[model samples]
Target: MSLLNGLPAHVLLVHVVVVLVPLTALVLVICALWPQGARRLGPALPVLALVTLASVPLTTGAGEWLERHVADDPLVRRHAELGDGMLPWALGLFVLAAGVWLISRRTPAAQAGARSGAVLRVAAAVLSVVVAAGAVVEVYRIGDSGAKAAWHDAYSKTATRPGDGD
Candidate 1:
């Protein structure tokens, strides 16, 4: 129910994805402005694009693995569902990252990409804010729900034993 128990080794990388995927995209967005500078930075947008894309699968896989062990309470399910809902968020960011990469590299296409980048950057900022807020709400909701569920299960089990009376 806490970070230690809630987050496990198997899905630890998933947490990394949640944090890093956006990070890379944001960085790429900045780098997109200076293609020459971005080129000097590292492997380029293709690699960054792949890394961003990889997070989607990694996050999903890790979450599914974690969910298997966690109890199927609504609160827990809600958290899992939250992750599911973010699939689109992650996908959009990845797409934007890819576009930024292309625009930065493609001189002829840079104008269109720059326009798209402007829009993408704004969208990224908005989504980042929204996602951060959503994560907080989901965490709080899931925690409260899990606590209630745990208590309910404990109470029911206590009352159902042969020697126990409600």
Candidate 2:
């Protein structure tokens, strides 16, 4: 069985990663800042993080495969480079989500302890916020670059077609 069955996997998987990663980041930030929200989300945050993390590598691998089959242009290369940088941010958000989940699971007494009480919770929240912010920014960067690479030339060509007015 062929891996992609003659289709470009990148075209199929990029959408999932693009949508899920930012969504996960937003959820992570919300859970971090809101205790009741975190309680309601329960196990969902970590699971979302895991899925987002998994999707990144898949999207990247597909992108690499697609890259090999396409002409090397500055826009595509820039998008590829930006895409390669996404894994770390995705991984960081995953780690932060896991950390937040673990911290939230501790007992009331354990959370109230001197070392692991309010201070730890605050620290986790702050760190989660920072990581979530970074992840969101990275997602925007990747999406913007990818969109530009994918459409810039097509739009340019269309605009410059014969008999077309400026």
Candidate 3:
């Protein structure tokens, strides 16, 4: 898993984490807040969350491997530190998503009354929103750090060809 097609695997796997984590978070929030959305997407929410959660480790592991192979720099080290924190957020999102899905799937006869169901849904919705927000922000921070690490000195202000004026 260290390399893929002669490129660091992190280069490929990070994209999956980048896309799916936010996508799952958005879907979890939507399904939590809207009953119609819950009804339509509840069954799939857990699956999506699971997939997103799974991607985090694969990405970070590949990132760790790449980090070891590359020259050590403070920016890259910072990015790696931030990247290590993603798993917990992803796990929280998955747990909340699964909880929301289970709540959404409750049968009418299985509940005490509509009032209690609404209360549970609202509570779950609030928690989901909070967790989703945290997850998204963490992703942004990790991505920003990673971008800086990758491109901090990759180019100058002026664009130049390989042999311009050389």
Please provide, for model 1 over 53-72, each residue's C-alpha lDDT reduced to its tens digit, 9 standing for 90 to 100: 66656665666676677777
Clashes of each: 0, 0, 0
lDDT, residue 149, model 1: 44
For model 3, the local distance difference test gives 0.91
Residue 80, model 1, lDDT:
65
The residue pairs that clash in candidate 3, if any, are none
Number of the candidate with higher lDDT, 1 or 3:
3
Name the runs in model 2 displaced over 4 angstroms.
Answer: 1-7, 113-115, 156-166
TM-score of each: 0.53, 0.85, 0.91
CA lDDT of each prediction against the hidden true structure: 0.55, 0.83, 0.91
Error of 3 at 122 (Å): 1.5
The stretch of ten residues in a row with the least summed lDDT in candidate 2 is 157-166
lDDT by residue (tens digit), candidate 3, 71-113: 9899999999999999999999999999988887887565447
